[model samples]
Every structure is written in C-alpha cells, then in structure tokens.
Target: MPAVIVNIQGPYTERDRKLYAFLVHAVWDELGVKRIHELPVARINKVFEEHHSDTSQGWIWESAKRLAMTSVEWAQVEGEDRLHGIAHLFSYAATHEAARADGVLKFEFPAGLIPVLKEPRRFARLRIHFLIALSGKYAVTLYEILESVANLRNPVLEIELTKLRQWLKVPEDKLDRYVDLKRFVLEPGIRQINMNPEGAGFSAQMEALKSGKAVERIRFVIQKLDTRVALEKQIKPRLEPPVPPPVEPMSAFGILLSTRTYEKAKQAAPDFDIYGLEAEWRDWIKGKPRPNDPDAAFVGFCRKRQRRMEVG
Candidate 1:
C-alpha cells in the first residue's frame, strides 16, 4: 500500500483532501491503467458538482496552483525494503488553459509515485467515490488508514497516542488534553465514517486506554455491517455527495462559532455585543497559539472583558 503524508494546515483543507482523492480516482479508475502517469482533462464539476454546486471556475485553477505548490511525502512499503521520496502533489498540472474554457483539470503523477501505481503489488481497494463521500480530513484519512487493514479477519487496530496524532496530522502543540482529543478528533471522525450508507457502511469505535490518568493509546474496533458487503461491494464507481456537517453559527468576521461558545458568550456578556467580542477575541488569538477547546477559550475571553468593564 502507498503511504501519503501532507501538512494538515494551509491549502490542505477538507475540500483539498477530497480533491486529492478525486484526482487519484480519475487516474486509477477513469484513466487507462496503461496511462498511469498522465490524466486527461476531466471536468471538476463532474467530480465535485454534487458536493458544491457553486464551485467556481477560479477554484479549479487555484486548487491546481495549490497542488503544484505544496509538497507531500510519498512512500510505498514492501515487506523489508521501503521506497520514499518527496514531490509536489502533481509533477505538472494545467487547469488554466485559455484554450479550454471549461472548468477542467489535467495533471501528471509525481515520478516517485508513478511506479507504485503502475502495478501495485499490495494495495487496498480504496474506492474514490467512498473516500470523497466521507466528510472531514480526519474521517477521510481514518477511512483510508483503516481500510488498508480491513482485510484482516475481525481486526482490532491499536496505536500509541503519539502515532495517532502523527497520522491525523494534529499539530503536536494542539489538542493536548485527552478530552479535547476525544471531542475534536476521535468522535467526530468516527461519526462521519459510520454515518454514510454510500460510504464504507461499517461501524467503527475508539477506546482510549489510560496509563494512570494519562491517555496512552487508542484502540479502533471496526465492525462490518455485512462482513461480505463491507469487505467486497463492487458498486459501479460514482461520486456521491455526503450529508455535510451541520452549519455552525458564524462570528461577525465569518469565523465559525460552536453552539456551546455562542451560548456561553450570551451568558458571559449579556450587555455586550457577542459577535463583536468574538471578532475581538479571534483577532487577539491570531499571534497566540490556542488550545484545543475553542469554546472554553472564548468564554474565558468574555469573562475578562466583563471584568474589565466592571473595573473600568
């Protein structure tokens, strides 16, 4: 199986991750296996329309730019020997060809990655449709990581805490509290994976094992909806839009605010304009690194603001 690692921040947004999967599916499933390196111009809407109808022509070019700009670690694991290299997601990509007004993208597989795709000796049969269907970066990543081992008879995959963070690309400085880890990463990701019928359609669970009071490892237990169907379903490959995550309330600056944060803000600063304070809080947090629980952070800020008003 091939291993891919990308920095989770910056252009590696949820949309970009799905686009990456879309590109892979286009190459492996649509483009002829013989033409393993070059991808013919394919309509971005054909792949992305169901998910975002308002997807603009500019986005295709911009995404192509990001792909050309960002580098990813590519590795293929064989029994004892390992192959590793770094390259831009695309060796070359052209999405802004004036000759083609249609919103389409064409790209070449990075050279280091071409050999692995040509004839994969050991590979997981990852469906491009299901991968894009899964929501969130963590869910998409977790599904891919878990599917690699799904072939094992009733597998219970367990990893130490540190390794899981590395795989999920959770910044080491962020999501430090185990409760925060569970709330922000583990549960949400698992819910996204288990929520879709068009997806893997298998139930997954995470159990955090503690050493004294500290979380030491996470154990993922995957249960097949139908052992046969879960492992071997050859639905005609088609990308289907997933049920998107619920829209969270937005701050005045268009930043998303969790419901808990909103409610606490209302309580913390009844006489104050909550969204305005949220905007102020967000700005103040810009240069400062923040903890995992953003709701708590915002609440604390509001309390300080209230105190300042009383003292002043």
Candidate 2:
C-alpha cells in the first residue's frame, strides 16, 4: 500500500545513493532509539573506498547538501489528525567545527517518517556491503526489488513497464523506447547484479511482456542461488540424480550446511581444505547409493582421507 507521496526537486545521483545507503546502515540498529545519529565520515568512506579520502569531509558535506535540497511532500491524514506539509528528505543535515575534527556527519529524518523507518519488516533484507558494491541507480534499485522476494520459492516479480521505469528513476526525456530501456538499463543492470563482487546472493534476469505489439510489463525472475551449489558447481557439475539410497553424507549440496556440520567437518579434516574436500566428496558420491544421514557422511569422508594421508 502506498502511504506517502514524495515530490523530489533534485538529481539523485550515485553519490546520493552512496550516502543514502550509508545512512541506512548507520542508523539501522538505532531506528526507534534515536532521532538523530552522528555518522563517522571515515567509516563511511571506508565502505566506499574508491570515493572519499580520510579527510573528505567536503565530499560528504556536498552529498548532505543535495539531500537537504531534495524535499518531500510529507502529508498524512490519520482519522482527523492530518499532517500536510513540504519537508526535506532529512530534517536537518548539519555540520560543525567538531564534525570536521571528529570526521562525522550529523543528520535526522522527518519525525513523521519514524513509523515507516521503524518497521524494518517492510524493508528489504539487504547488506550495506552488497548494496554499495552496485554502481548506477538502475542496478542498485533493480537489485533491491529483486532481492526482496528472492528467498521465496522460485520467485518471480512482475510490474508495469511504466511503474518499473518510474521505480528505476529513468528520466522521462531519455530511453523512451522499450528496446532502449532493455538494452541500456535492464540488461546492464542484470549483468552488474550477477557479477557484483560482494555477490547479490541470487541471480536475476528481466523478461518483457507485450500488449498486442507494444511492451507493457516487465517480469523479473530470480532464484535463491544458495552458497553450497554456488561453490560446488564451480568445482563440479551436478548431473542426473543418483538412484535412491538412504542418502549420502553431505549430499545436501544445494542447502546451507548447519554450523554442526561445519564443526564436525573441521574436526574430521583438521587442517584439510574443508570446502574443497566437500566438493571432492560430492564428486566422489556420484552414482553411489548411500545412507540417509548424509550430513554426517561428509565428516566420514574427511576422516577416511585423514587416515589415508596418515598411512601414506
């Protein structure tokens, strides 16, 4: 449900996104506790290592100024209590002599937005590292939307082309054609999302649906590419399913292994490459019939490898 209407009056650039992400990460833990937060500029600079130097107080202040200039029409009518007024994205973005010395940035959101900010449940479950790793507005925005539902069983997201364009903040004067939008924004965004160094935790793609000849909707399909197979597939290609046995140990390749598995795996292998050994074990189990308790089997594989190494 749409709750608020925001009319922006300034450009939302990559730097703006960086500062926004920094603010989100900085204030995440203190949502309901504090209205104002002081962000350490050096720490934020570290997150965006390529951008600002240790003394880049000037750079952060510029971004903060942009945010202050951007205003939102924060109007809410709850029963008889109506809040109707124009407000900036942040209530106050101020700096002092102490801010320069301490290398900090002080800011606060409009009080009316507190209810929205406090409800983390509606926010996407994303890491600040993953978010900042993405460059460009489209790629970052696309990732946030896709990742929100990526954990759902074989998730797919569909939105009107107009709405998608608006969500991506595609300028009205540019990329008017569907082909152009797909070529410039959708494809490149998907590539960057898939290739991000931090890893998006899932893979994604966009599909265009048409209404009689004109494209009208965009469909985004995503899969939860869990770490196990993401690691194992590079080492070995999974083939046809093995005939049903009890199940081999550590055969749960696509699923995340429990800490219990990791502990035992470490104990069995000791100094062995646990992950690589896991891949080798997975490869060895091919076409073999095995026990149902496959989780413990991985430890057994390591122990056997240890014994062989000991003897030789």
Candidate 3:
C-alpha cells in the first residue's frame, strides 16, 4: 500500500492494473508475517466495486491469469546484482476452477519479491479511492511516482528523461519529441491526476535540465496540498442548493439534437433553422431503422438538406 516496486512492467490493461493494485492492498497488512494470502472471490469482486462499481466472472478470471503470468525484473546493488523471472507476480496460484465458480483466490508470493513491496526504501503512499477512478495508465503511473516522493523535505523528484519514459512505460516511437511528450503525455496525465474531486493532493511542474540548449534531465517539482484548504473547499460547496441534472432524451433523433452534433449541423447550415431541420430529419427517418451513430447520421442529413436548399 505504501511502496511501489520500480522498473516493473506488464499488467497492461485497466482491469489487470486494478487487479494487481488490489492484490498489493490485500497483502499489505500481512506483508512480513505471511507469504501466502487467500481472498474470497466475492471480496476481490467487492474491491472492484468499491473502485469501479462493477465486475464480471470473465474479467476476474482473465485478470487472475494475467497477474499469475506477469514477470518483474530488477537489479540488486549488492550480492546477485541482477534478477529476472516469469510468473514473478506470485509463487503459486491455486484459484483456477474455484475462481471461475466465485470461490476463494489463493496466492503465494516469492520470498525475495515480498520485501520489494513490503519494505521499500522509497515508496509512494496514495489513497486507493483516488486511484480507483483514474482512467488512464499514465495518470496512475505519474501519481504513484510523484506521491512516493511527496513526503520528502524537498518534495522534488529529478530523473533523466529516458528513465522517466521507462517508468511511464512509454514506447520508443511514441512521443519521441520533447514538446510532443510535454503536450500530449505529461500535461494530460498531470491534468487527469489533479482533476479528481477529492483533490489529487499534489501539483507537478516539469523543469528542463539543459546542456547547451539540449534538454537532458527533467525535474518534477511536486508540492503537497494543504489539507485544511482542500477540506474547506469541499465543505463550502455543500451550503449551496443542489443543481438539477440535465434532461436525457428518449429517441435517437432527440439524442442527436441534444448533442454537439446539433451545433455542428447549425455551423454547416447557418441559415437553416435547426428546429425545422430536426422536424425534417424526424420525418425522413420515419418507418426506417435507427442509425448506430445517430450524431454522424444527423450531420450527414443536415449537409444533404443544406445542399438541396442551395440547388432549389
């Protein structure tokens, strides 16, 4: 729960990531005392619900298999110096058939790998609730890396750009340019992390280390938020009256009209009244099948209508 093993990979899918994180939490309390942990399939599913509000048997089984097969490699400064192996996620998995039937899941971790999670020299402590709602892998990765160092006196984590990319699991070809990485990856990841309702609890800014105009190291200046201020903001909003939610449309045409598709239609045919066009479209689609992509279909109809009016 507190430490993250660095230079780890795989658990690529969202479900897989959540499953691995849940396993870490499950074993956290019993880290040193026990090598094996058993969790009821119901409880594991509950963990998913606590975060995501839903789960299925197929997803659980797939995630379990993925975790069991995943490998983690790391370098040791002393003694062996380097280590690598498959199925390093756990030493044993005995939940094959039972897991499918909603039974218990039993996991046994490798002895040496236990301490990597159990007793890390440096690690990030984060609220599991905050992590649950995060949709992007990059957001989760950056949050963990930054949160790990948030408690330090300096609260600044500086790493080489290459190493940062590796930690982020960025492919070599993607975001190859520094500007592109900052624009697409770094900014969006930080934005998503900070946008959480409970507050991301930290702010990050990237500083470039330049050697004769060539950027090298990236310094992440992380600052922890003051809890008092965050709490005040949360409380102040409750005093106001709750606003009513937007009305949802029932029919396909209504759905399209209520969406940004309506705005696009207006733009494509500025002189054409959207209300009248909606009526025309509703009539045009009468006795016909509904479109799978109503928004696109609406736009196409509007363009055709605009062209016909021009010809007339």
Candidate 4:
C-alpha cells in the first residue's frame, strides 16, 4: 500500500494500469533512491494471474515489452527551480543468458525522477487489489487522491475543478461542463470506489461549491469504514496451487507432448496448424538424441518452424 509519485496520462487500459501498479509495487523498496531492480517474470506472471487469470508465457513477455515502452511525463516545481522531462517506465535489459533463460526483467529507474518516487510525508497508500477491480481510470485516480487524505484529522479535501480534472488526466474536450463532469466522472467514480470492499476502507461523497449559481470548487467528504467491519471484509483466503481437473486418457501423441510444452507450442505458433506442426516436429526429432528439457526443445522447434513458415 505504499505510494509512489507518478505523472501518468489519461485513457489507460486495464492491462496498462495493472502493469503500472505492479511496477510501483516492485520498486517500493528502492523508491527515492537511484537503483536498478531485478523483477522475475514468474512473480509478475503471478500478479497477472491474480488480476487477469491468463498467464501464458508469451503473453507475459509481450506485456513486459509493452510496459517498458510506455512513456510518462514528470514535472516538479521547487520555488525558483523547475524540472520537467519524459521517460519510459523503466529501461530494460536481460543482463545474462541465465537471466534471459529464467525470464528475469531488469529495470533501471531514471535518476531525475528518483526524488519524486522516494518517501514523502504526503502520498497515497493505494490498495492495489481494489484498484485492480476498478475498470475506469477516473475511479482509480479519485480513489488514490481520496485515500491519501482519508487518515487526516479533517477528512474533507477540497480542490478546484480544473486542478481535479488535471490530476485525473481527463481529456480537455471530455466533461467540459460542470454538470456533465459531475454526472459522468465524479458520480460513477465515487460510486465504484464506495462499492468496492477493499477500496481505501472509506465511502466518499462530493459537495459542489457554487459561485453565483455556477459550481466553482468541489469538496470530498471521506468517511472511514468501521474498523471491525473493514477487517472482516478484507480477510482473504490463502493462495494454494491449483488442482488439475480430471481429464480423459491422452492418445500416444498427446502423452508425448507434456501440457507445458503444448501450451508453449500453441503460443509460439498460433497461426500454424498445431496438429500438423506437432507431427512434423515429432518426425524431425525421431532419430535425434533426447533433449534434457523436452519442453524447451519443443518450444524451440515451434519457434524455428514458425520462422521458416514466415520466410516461406
């Protein structure tokens, strides 16, 4: 639930938000300090499984590439000094063959942005699990801002409409009118956050400040949920290994291809006829020495076959 200061753009897809959240959590220990971190693909895949339920190795790899390419703008103003720049989430490298083989992702934080990411007295301790369930970017943004001030002695936070829109990264043309903004963005986001059991353990409502019949600023009233009720609802079941469902007996060919290898092959050669490719792979490997790791060998065969097909 630690917070990291980030300047992100609007219209973030669900996967992108999840990836961003993961990155924030991954670098929590090193936040505020210039340091590189090693994040294993397996750990990231575990989070993907919890949030997305699909953790194919190829999909994970592709997602990591996408996350690495995402750019964000950072700006800080300290009295007479002003700093601003754009950078990707992190710089990536495999470092070693063993690291690549094991699917380790190395991330180097930008030195200039370390100060913002470091420990700060005022920051949002966002509950990642709740954020995962929220589909709208507005909901996530509002939840973070409200959660940051939820524990303050006075639970009322006020901000101008323009600043709120900026912080939420709302597009300029979208929700231009106060009524439209309240009806579309504010109402739905507040409703979603309040409905989520793990969302900051608070319910939020907004009061509009009117200037001569025109809404000027908005105030958020955040009320914390009862401690006992919050604790009871937050209890989560311990994670355990998934039990394989019973299946019919496999054919000879099916038995030869382990589940892991078959999945890898499917991902690697989605366009190729899997049965035909399997037959070809089987025939090609017939006279060869048995591979130490059959799954890896099968994946390699699928990749090579895919390349050949692309060339042909």
Best candidate according to lDDT: 2
**Pairs clashing in candidate 3?**
124-148
Give the candidates in order of TM-score, highest first. Answer: 2, 3, 1, 4
Score residue 41 of candidate 4 by CA lDDT: 69
Which parts of model 2 are misplaced by more than 4 Å? 1-9, 50-55, 71-87, 97-101, 118-124, 151-154, 196-198, 227-312
RMSD of 4: 17.1
What lDDT does candidate 3 reach at residue 203?
71
Model 2 over residues 1-312: C-alpha lDDT tens digits? Answer: 223333344665766765675575456545555788777776566556643323455777777878877764544666777766666667888776654645778888887665553332223245445566576777777776676666455589888888777667788889999999998889988998777522466677788899999999989988654553355456545534445565453323222234467568878867565655665675676446654666777788889978887888
lDDT of 1 at 165: 84
Q: Give the CA lDDT, 0 to 100, for residue 7 in model 4.
A: 56
Candidate 1 on 203-290: residue-level lDDT in tens?
Answer: 6888999999999999998775553342243321212322333543222121234445666877987656554455356545543444
Model 2 Cα RMSD, Å? Answer: 13.3
Error of 3 at 171 (Å): 1.9
Better of 1 and 2 by lDDT: 2
TM-score (C-alpha) between model 1 and the true structure: 0.61
Considering every candidate listed, which one attains the maximal TM-score? 2
- lDDT per residue (tens digit) for residues 1-312 in model 3: 333344656656656665666567545545556677777777666645755545676566676667777676654454544444323776776775634646777777777776665444222244444565676777777776777776676889888888888878788899888888888778887787666423455677778897788778889887665642343344444434334335432232222232356568878776565544554565455334667776687788889878887999
- Per-candidate alpha-carbon RMSD to the true structure: 18.4, 13.3, 16.9, 17.1
Q: How displaced is residue 8 in candidate 1, in Å?
A: 7.1
Off by over 4 Å in 4: 1-12, 32-34, 53-88, 91-102, 119-124, 197-199, 226-312
Q: Which sections of candidate 1 miss by over 4 Å?
A: 1-10, 29-42, 74-83, 97-103, 115-124, 127-130, 227-312
- Compared with the true structure, what per-residue lDDT tens digits does model 4 show for residues 177-230? 999998878998898977753334678889999889988899999887664233
lDDT value, candidate 1, whole model:
0.59
